[model samples]
Target: MRTLTLVRRVAPLILLLVVLAVLTVRAAEQLDNQDTYFHLRFGHELLGEWSLRDPGSVSSFATADWVPTQWLPQITMAAVEDRAGLAGVAWLSGLAFLALALTLYVVARRRVEPLAAAPLTALALVASSSGLSARPQVLSYLLVAVTATAWLAAARSGRTPWWLVPLTWVWACCHGMWPVGLAIGGVAVLATALRPDRRWDRVARGAAVVALSGLATLVTPVGPRLLGAVVAVDERREFFSEWGRPDPGDPRLLALLALLLVAAAALAWRGTDGPRGPRTLRGLRESPDLTALGLLVLAGGCTVASGRTVPVAAALLVPVAATALHRHLGDRPAWTRLEQVVVLGGVALALPVLAAVVPHTADEPPARPAWTDPALAALPAGTPVLNDWNLGGWLMWRHPQLDPVMHGYGDTFTVEELRRNTDILALRPGWRTLVRETGVSYALVRPRSPLGRALVDDEGWRVLHRSPDLVLLKPPPGWM
Candidate 1:
């Protein structure tokens, strides 16, 4: 009876922790993608150049007008590398994510009933599938959670936290998506202002905090250039895959979306006057703050449909789902002692299976080859290389010495550059010009790429080494 009672009290928290732990483990195990490599290389450059700009004018590849928007996270990873190498960086990222999940769980727990918090945390863990990459977005995701939680507290208490403004500035430097924190604050201000009883003085103070925090986002290493970079990238949405519409066939994303829709409908049904009575609706309608939370749900759903908005969606959805669940189900009865034992035992048995299957949505790493050359072994010292975004992570891991033209800093590169690179790699005409224009000395081509096969067939480009997954190509003598 004692064990059952204990389990009943703690089972939800255990489930939430298990889900986040599984996600961290999976994200850690996956190979570094191209974006990872880009950031790593940039970190190395920062060490040498001491600035975001390339100083030596070494290669057009290195001088491709890239900005390190997530400078703090990358720098942190780079610092880890100096101590423990690539694996250390990977471990650090996983730890950071674990911390993020815990913070989110705490925020959700505070806003919702204890029983509803567990499932909401689980859903947040699942929704986080998209933002698990070793990019700056991870930091952005964490910041969004913190900002949202703080804003929520401010809304409920009418005491806007002064510290949130500096945190916004730090978020901007960490990633260009600093606007998200401001948006969260803006929502909180709107919610507070909607209260008929609240005075304008308090409302104005909240709005001022939001505006000041937004302005503080400009106090980064890049300053105004941060906004320029973000705008430039956002304008080129047509060129990016995430910016495109979501694929209907993606089962995990579709399932999550369906679950969110159900949750939203449940909220509306329970909150509005229904067969139950106006009394139920009255309670919900009185909480204008809760209605503001519904706005977050709507935003998350719209963003998820667009595919590019997964991060934003995941960050907002967790709390909204928790709130909805609490409003709808918090009054339900607790389990009996026997029922508690059964539930706890069942959850214990089910956790491992969920851990194994839920971490990665895809069967294999996306757009990556099964094998790759020993990048560190083949490249000449100081070789200027043009690489695919997907393969950048491996190259950064394998070859810390060589500089790459670009990796996965999407917000850093202009739309024109992104489009040009996409065309070069995906199509034939752009590939040839890219090879020439970058003055690429060595090419690291994925085995599945048509250009890799063409490079092998062409006599002018010698295949120095080949692996089932990656091929290393060098220009013939006198071509350079």
Candidate 2:
């Protein structure tokens, strides 16, 4: 009784600590990336005018593009900035992450022993933290958690919540990953609809929920244009790095994926044809919902196998894993309490060790001044500057007056535009033509890159700024 009591009390705290550790590590490593700048700019733009469209923009690079997917988060960030500036944004992000962690704990508590939920929550936090940034991805993560909790609750009680569908509609406007939420909901509906022995009424209700959620996704600020853009981007996986197939060589991702797969297989084997396991599996065989959970597990594993899908894997796995652990463990055994205490104590003891291993300082140079060229600096305010992908975020944040030719707006640029720009930088002919056609008055290049060296050596362009890791160049006099 004492052991069970201790496990119940400490599990939530362990989960919270693990989440904080993950978020802290992520914050330390990923503070000043290009995507951060894009979101920051979006926040500034929205706060200034409550519009997604950029005003006073000179770049031919689709200034009117409405990034409705990231709009709500941007609006929220704008509000944070109004209250506390950039520091507030960071705090807000941290709080948002904390909220997500709490939701994970709640979901876990419902499905698994509170003590067992700690490790699952920790794993989910670590996996999701990889993709955690001040971008639309964060919003997607939160929405996924919210959707999962609702679905799980609805599944347990036969009555699907009416509010979840409309919430998804709002979510659709807030992030491009709305499709993921819809997919999860579809799985739930299919599970309900396909349950052979279950009453058709329950299945019908699930199907209706799924249909409404799908329809809700269309009611965004840009309406069908949002869907069109999403479809276009989805169809162009070859053009984007994150959209591409996952590389098998990444050790961290691979290891976690392997562990998850092993756990899943172990659970399946233990549940199948094993007299020692819980009764849940006996009933699960006929329930489409359980089968859907298994599919979700598989989907999450595939996502984790590819670095691009890490966030998706994190979002989908937590609840499913908790549910599985819950069904398997049922009531905690008396001896399990000692194991729980040991695990919690070990996690506590290792906190300092983990902290020491993770970098504490942001040693990376200030992205704006470090990358901006003197020529671009001398140009009139609002000059359109072409910048590298990594530097675009910082430029957007520091130089809101200047409209960048391109930034980290992943959905804003067409696949053709991305291909053209990428090809130009990779090949000499494309590079030169891009410089000429874009009327790029300034170019921000990473100093270590071959393109930066080429620009410095070429007489056609002048190096206007230099830093340890960045270089700025300008077109020759009389050329744009």
Candidate 3:
């Protein structure tokens, strides 16, 4: 009995420490995501300029008036990068990911035993892994986890979460997903109304909380204009792969699918009464808290909506799934204070470990070579370079002096510019003319791309540098 008791006491700390170690190592493995480049550069520019409007100077092809919706985290990242370089940014990312894991576990442990809560939390992390990059979106994910937990608690306690208003304000400044939190609040209000002991006063107060949260978003630096920025991105979703449909074969999606299935099975089993089972569908309907059911439905919708929302769905599902699985284990004692301290304290030590490792491991961008810096610096400022979409952010950050014709920021380009950039890169019928019109004499792109092949084979551009991954080519003399 003593051995079993000791094992239970030590397990939670072990679980969190293992998670911290895994996430820290993963986050420290080189900075390669294309958007991370532009975010850091933009953050630095915002620090210097103190503005939310893009200068429209980062790329020569940007025709849209871009609003920087994700300024707060960008500025924070820029400050960290300035003081400690990219390693600091990696350490910061490790901290954000650790916070996310701890938040999920703490919330789950409130209603579920530690053993049950731990696995459910792990499943949610795996489901959310695809969206866990070192970007402002990570902040949004953390806020989503908080929002879901607060609303779920309020659903049972019959109290409104007034604190969510200020959180929404901070979330708006950090990322464009503040509205999602408000939507969950709205759902919670409806769930409160559906309870068997529903109180009209509680329902009204819940609605007020959601209203105030929405209003809070309007007060951020971008103010009412923030809504327009979010809508603009949605209108141009075709150009962004993140906005595409969730792939059925993605392992993250598979994890989420398994989680949803398990939660549903648990709910179904709970409604049964031995061999007789639930007398009617009505029993099943009233079996679980309406708030949990509503959140699960929301998770399902997010899962089907697009690839970008999978993490949101996973966040929404964790608290409900943990509690649902706990129903099978019967009632258990809540975590002791010492147990909480051990788990949290161990997670905290990850920061120092990450600080030591990241500086060495995450010093360079993955796609950039040792020779890239000197080669690009040789070109004069304002020299137009033909580059594919993937290379645009790197050039924008490392060599803002040279203008690139296309980049990954979809909302910054007009519809015509986006389609034209695609056509040129794909080597469509008018690609040659489009390339010439840009006045680009230098090309930095994949050697195997259609544009690269056309420039070398048909236009006879000379290879200035060659690598298996990328090639630098110069147009024939007098061609520009």
Candidate 4:
């Protein structure tokens, strides 16, 4: 019995570790998004003359209203880079993956049988993998998971934890999507208030917490102006592919559909007679995880509206699935002593192997394109250059002296600047004129871009460097 209990206890921990290790390895495989560089640059600047009171713009345009909610991620990644170089960044990414997975699992296990939690967790991971980049949004996912969990706990305990109020402030400073925490808290509060046997005390407490969480968000660098940032994103959503409305082809949608189907089937096939289990409508409505399901629906709706929101859906849905699946299956049997010993031994041996093989420390950080580094090395320092929108952060990071016409700090550039950059890549009318007007005699562009193709035919331009991924173009001898 003791051995079986120990195995049962270790099983969830083992599962969490497995998820963490896998995510960490994935982070090790690559750096993060294009915006990571500009974030890092901002972090480094924050340590210097750049005051938070008037955090000046890094890009070409004046962006006095711009403020980064990714303050912690920026500073931390910069510190890691300064210390351990690219290897440290990989480590941080892995740790965040672990934190997110574990946060979801901790909330899930309360309403789920240990045995059923593992597979459901895996399913959740698969569905959410689309959003698994080392960005501040990752932190938001983790916080959302925590908020979901806390609210579930509150439903059972009848007292909202006051500490959660302050957590909102920290979360808002960490990520732009901090409103997600408020959304989750509101859903939980609403669910509890609407319960047939409602506890008005809990409802009152929940309403207060959710409201407090909202006001706490006002305690950020941007203050109430954060709403402006969110509005700006919504206004310009058409400009970004990630923000574009979700499609049927998104794999996460299929995963969510499958989970929903399973729930319906579980209800339809519930033991049809006496002593009905918790799978029925009455019992499910009373289930604490129902609140989690509501959160999942909210997240899923967001994901359907924008593909980049898969993390929010995935983070909230996994725990809800785990609880529902566990309720349907009921309790599972524990492993025997012999089985426990074998599993423990296997895990012990596996740890060293994973440590040795998984992290390829020598591999270059994905954010820093090595090809661009070499090509840019050949160009003179401070050369005014035109580049891909994605490489803006990389150029600013790697070629500090170069005057990049654009990079990842989107708000720093006007709508016209963004459109002009797009025109250069799309090979639109007057692209050459615009390029010259911007005083860019040199252009570094993705090899596959229409601009590169146009440059190939133009006699006035010469190729200074050519690679499979990038093409550097300059004016011919007399044209310059």
Best prediction by lDDT? 3
Off by over 4 Å in 3: 1-13, 53-56, 275-286, 330-332, 477-480
Best by TM-score: 3
TM-scores of all models? Answer: 0.79, 0.82, 0.93, 0.83
Count clashes in each candidate, considering only residues at least 3 apart in sequence or on different chains: 4, 3, 0, 2
lDDT of 3 by residue, 195-222 (tens): 8888999999999999998888777877
Candidate 1's residue-wise lDDT over 1-480, tens digit each?
Answer: 999857756777568657755765565464435567556666666766657532232234433464567777777767767776555666566666666666666656665644566666566666666667667787777777677777666765778678988888888778777777777777777767677777788789888888888788666666666676676666767766877887767655754574477457656654546687675432365443553464465556556556756656666766665555555554434444643453344444444443354344322234433334354455676677766666655565556566666565555455666776777677646466666777778778775686676666754688766777777778787654
Those runs of model 4 whose alpha carbons end farther than 4 Å from true positions after fitting are 1-21, 61-64, 199-201, 262-271, 274-290, 325-363, 366-382, 476-480
- Sort order, lDDT high to low: 3, 4, 1, 2
CA-lDDT, candidates in order: 0.63, 0.63, 0.81, 0.68
> What's the lDDT for residue 131 in model 4?
75
Worst 10 residues of 3 by lDDT: 277-286
Q: Candidate 2 on 3-89: residue-level lDDT in tens?
A: 877757676566556556666455444355457656766666766765543332323564435445677787787776666555555
Collision pairs in model 1: 33-393, 34-392, 34-393, 371-469
TM-score of 4: 0.83
**In candidate 3, which residue pairs get closer than 3 Å at backbone N, Cα or C atoms, i.e. clash?**
none
User: Which lDDT value does model 1 have at 21?
Assistant: 54
Residues forming the 10-long window of minimal summed lDDT in candidate 2: 357-366
Q: 2 or 3, which is superior by TM-score? A: 3
